[model samples]
Target: MPRIKTILMAGTALASVLVLTPSPAAAQSTTKPKAEEQQEAETSTAKADRETLLDTITISATMINEAVFDSLSATSYVGDKDLERIQANTPADIFKTTPGVGASMNGDDPATAINIRGLQQYGRVVVTLDGARQDYWRVGHGSGSFYIEPDLLKAVTVIRGPVSNAYGSGGIGGLVAFETKDAGDFLNADEQYAISEKIAYESNGEGFTTSTTAAIRPHQAFDIIGNVNWRDRDAYEDGHGDEVRWTGEEVTSGYGKATFRPAQGHEIKLGAIIQRYEDYVTGSSGSTSATLSRYDADTINNTYTAKYTYFDPDDRLLDYAFTAYHNKTKAEQTQVWPTSSIGNFRYYDVRTTGISGHNSSRFDWMGLAHTLTYGGDYYYLEGESSASHFGQGEAQAYGGFLQWMGHYSSWLELIAAIRYDGYHLDGETKGTTTTPPEDESLDGDQVSPRFTVGVTPFTGFQLFGGYSEGYRAPGLQDVFRGSGAHDTADGYIPNFGLKPEVAKSWEGGVNLKYDGILTESDILRGKFTGFYTKVYDYIETDFTITPRMTDNIGTARLQGVEAELIYDLGWGFINLTGALIDAELIDTDNPKYKGQPLENAPLDKFSATVGFRAFEDQLIFGGQYLAVGEVKRTQRSSGTNPGQVDGPAQYSDAFELVNLFANWIVSENLKIDLAVENLFDVAYTDPQSAWSYTSDVEQGKGRTFKIGVTTRFGG
Candidate 1:
């Protein structure tokens, strides 16, 4: 009876969505009659043509918004069109098309870990949603991970290195920032209200997704938007027709935001998001026990943010912003042990609160135009767990930064920045029969510096280079978390004296933007870059010791080259991306693991795609091919160490995959999308997934067909 009622309610909602929608003709007829319509149409088309030739603007690399072509560091932007083509359901799905990035999926929870330039875990990479930090970490057997529903994202931007120290601390690897949809994304210039609905399904997991959005502009000064989504999925089958356990999940999310413009040059935004996930996993965050316990888990994430901005074209000194945010994540698990005599329930929770203020000041000095940016921030993070064997702790960070951009001429630009970051940690341990009880505290601070120079040597060609230093402070999990102990004497131990990690990085790159190279309508945009990074006081567990313990493992280095190219032939587009990375532990205290390859680094990767637009830009089709090189396992420094350490590293072979997608706009009010992943049904494993302690290889998702439809009304 409950299932029946659910089905009935779903049917009613769908019916309401369709019935409330306005006709295509009504939506298009915004002005009275056909008067002035032709002029408006011509203006819109001209605006689009101009925008197509202009560079994309992004702010993830720095607090100030500027063109990507002008950026001093490597940056990638994912807009709405890219998300639609991939039929992205999770953050992992979207990142498959992005270069220099990888996602690790552990167990059933769809949220994946973000890896940039072969570095991840322990705050090395910072992930933010609408300027609020997504600092959820389980300290599990795999990488540190967080979850965010893709339906709420309007755009995603990535910075590949630590050139952006002004944003915050602990982003030595990079940063991924997600922007939520706003009222302007849906509402038409002349419309007062708008509604949009979307539905999607996938064949592999038999997943179904439904989402609805509403936007309203009640007055000239105020606007608001609201969104809700629901999804259900089952375990998916691999390429070999085998089911992957714990690969399914149920999710629901809600978001709402409002913007107010009280007066010219003043704006205020308030927003909130709530999401929940229900799934099953095998073990706790810090341990993968041999007992093979099954846990039914419920996870929740909630975030709220408020931002105020003041900007005026005539006032160069008042381009300023202030923001405050709070985020919370909770995970509850009910464990079912093989020995049914005992059952256990545990929970892990983390909360983060932060505030930031910044401003950009523009001035002219010595015949050069300059923009100076300065900012400061404070964040307080706390976490706790219910399990007796798990450790709990808290931390606080305060930081400030200053940056200066000098444009001597149209051909030469220079940038310099410095940041001071300080953090303090309070760690606690709950002792068991086999473990000791203790409480400890630690604190550290660092000053990071960066410099860059960009020059337009010739028309349509630009060259840039930079050097930077990144710093990451130890978090609670890295210092307090412990692996459970059994009857054996080799149980994991906690480390109270962990040191912070520091990275020195350098990069040189060339960007080319050429139009009319082949024909009047032809266009090409290309970027090629080479980067090297060395990390000091790298942190790793001392696996060679009995009952592994954390320690500073000396130094590690990664050097790589990345290339991207896109060409438009008036009717279609072709794109290519390639990367080659060498990562190793160059120096370490453990003699057994020195000069070994990193556990989850792929040496080489390449991908290519081609797409065409036809039928007056109403229909589009595209296909992509991806190839990855083999990854080597971490080896002991010497062969004389005791054998059989817990969760030894393993290697994976090279693999290739193919995908195809198509999109059609049936009418002004409706659109459809289709995608087929792993088109050849090839059996492969991703390096990120290979980190599972239980298996040497985790099978990647196989061939799957996805279809989606979107409808808009009352705009």
Candidate 2:
């Protein structure tokens, strides 16, 4: 497809960067045929000035979300001083600093995955925020999205590996982009118009998170920004508060952005986003004990965006962009089933709806730079169950992709991409029949590929490597489930006949930046990486009862190595990270489960930190340790049916946390800050939850403590 003719020649050179920016007032009113050569240029113009800042600092991670770092893959960035000290809801703290990537949630929940070089979620990798294509979580009764609301963010970029045809076929496992917050960056450089606020607290649980931001910018062309976030929670005790694990929750979110440059590298942007949530649960997966089973779950979301860009006034030879988007996700859950004669009670309702549309593009050649992206997606799902034995489902599909990035300058880099997908289904169940639901239509096609290489050879040392191929597509109640007793697969898994799961990966690392590199004066930062991945098919969970879903198991392998070290210590900073993974399950044909050990794969994990600072940068003190090691469910070959064996193989755990924070400027505009989370009193459980063989292990979050304060009004 010549990559769609290289994005149609990058949209005709982005309309020649809008005809050279209106010719700068027609070159100063076409005058000066030599008025004494402008009096010798006014004596060399009182000196000199040469300027270039990549047209106001190259936005969108480099025009249209370019992904080709680490040579076609492995890209990770999380700015804003690490979002002012972690607790970043989703994007798992910036994809764990990228590099062969691997992430886990279920511990504070965020609905995320990217495991490249090790292949995860859908098999290869694909994540997007500004350009759409997101499941956000709802894939198999999980209904995720991690409660999305991180103060409307400002930065987060990830491009792990294997980006199938550039971005298609569920990305086969590579792509992440959540870049928001732009309204001329809230002006105020003597131009006036500004306001900002933040309130936060952490110490295991018991929550209060508040945020506000505003920017108006009278004119340097035009700018407007608004952001808001609020979260409230009560329920703790695994470390304190007595005993309440992961409880009660409420969240409200909103953001608006507008920017118009009229001329000068031209631009136009409009946006809107909203989210509302109410939650309460006591161990999902059909609760048992820990009461509070009076469940509550609701999510409402809306996003609308339109974007355009053009640039090139010597601005790196090229720049181009076009964007359009719409998003909607409505989720609901309420339950209290389990009774017989004594108080007879029953009620279970589940609902989901999604609608999506999106598009993307970018390029710069001759210096060797190319990027081409394409899009198309649609969905409609319906459900209502209370053991009525009825159903309805529909999901349409269309997809396309092409990616190419080659730098050939500044020490090598190369990347390649491919993608194509098609899905369809429509159905009914004869007016809630006693037993008559198994009608369907199916379709499919997939192709994903990737390759990358990044090398610096010297200077702070940089060396990278990558390989890719991935796929995932099997939803809609896992292809028409039916029958009864929680019908899983209910019968026919031929909803267009499943098939689309493949993964192959690789990873190599070496990077040691500099600017402080230890001692040289204090400010230091360090990173270390190691990886391994092997897999095939691997998509378990099945019981064929009627529609009891989850399939594609047979082969699997996952190896791991992780490390991290950092020190900013201008006054205080310290961090250390570690991980180890070794998974199994191969050629499972089921027979009680071939070779087991794949329930939530975890071998070892660790985290440590130390911090202190006073006055100067304000007060802050910290100590933390999160640990996990030894876990087994054994009997692999594509697990799930391991039963009888005396249960539990091994489990080791640890958690020690102590924290306190304060920031008191108290002058030149006043400021205040405070924080404390799980200062000790540990009780943890987040090995990525298999729910402990279905549903049981819930204990986590205790010693609760949280407080936040902020003040600022107009400026």
- Top-scoring candidate (lDDT): 1
Q: TM-score of predicted model 1? A: 0.89
- Any idea what lDDT model 2 has? 0.50
- Distance (Å) between predicted and true CA of 336, model 1? 3.1
All models: lDDT? Answer: 0.77, 0.50
Flag regions of model 1 displaced more than 4 Å: 1-54, 284-291, 337-342, 388-390, 429-438, 485-490, 635-649, 691-698
Per-residue CA lDDT of model 1 for 1-715, tens digit only, reads 2332233344334333433343344345354446566754654564356345446677846688866656778877777777778777788777764667777665466556788887776578888888898888774445346779888888888888787667777989889888899898779899899898999999998989999999999897999999999999898777887776677899999899999999999999999999999987764321344566667879999999999999999999879999899999998888766577236778889899999899999999998999999999999999888754455788898899999889977899888899999999998654688977777798999999999998998776789999999999987777786665231265566787788999999999987666555443455676777899998988876666665566787788988877666766656887767677787887776666677776565336677789998887799898998777777676432223433332355667777789999999989799999999999988776766633434422367789999999999875
Model 2, 1-715: lDDT tens per residue?
Answer: 2332233244334323332223332345434568756753642341111011001222221124431222223345565434444545445545443434545544322344545544455324555555544444343322243335656876656554343324334554456666677866545467457777878765555567888877887887888888888877655455433444345567788778888989888788888778776764323432344432333556666666777776654555345555666556555545443332223223323233333323334456688765554444444434334433223365555555555556666767666555566666565433343665446666676665656676776554457666666556665455454432323223323334456566666766554443323322233333444545555766654542223445675777766654444444345665655545566666767644556566545435455566666664455556555444545554221124322323345443433345444445565444665545455656565444433334343455555455555655555
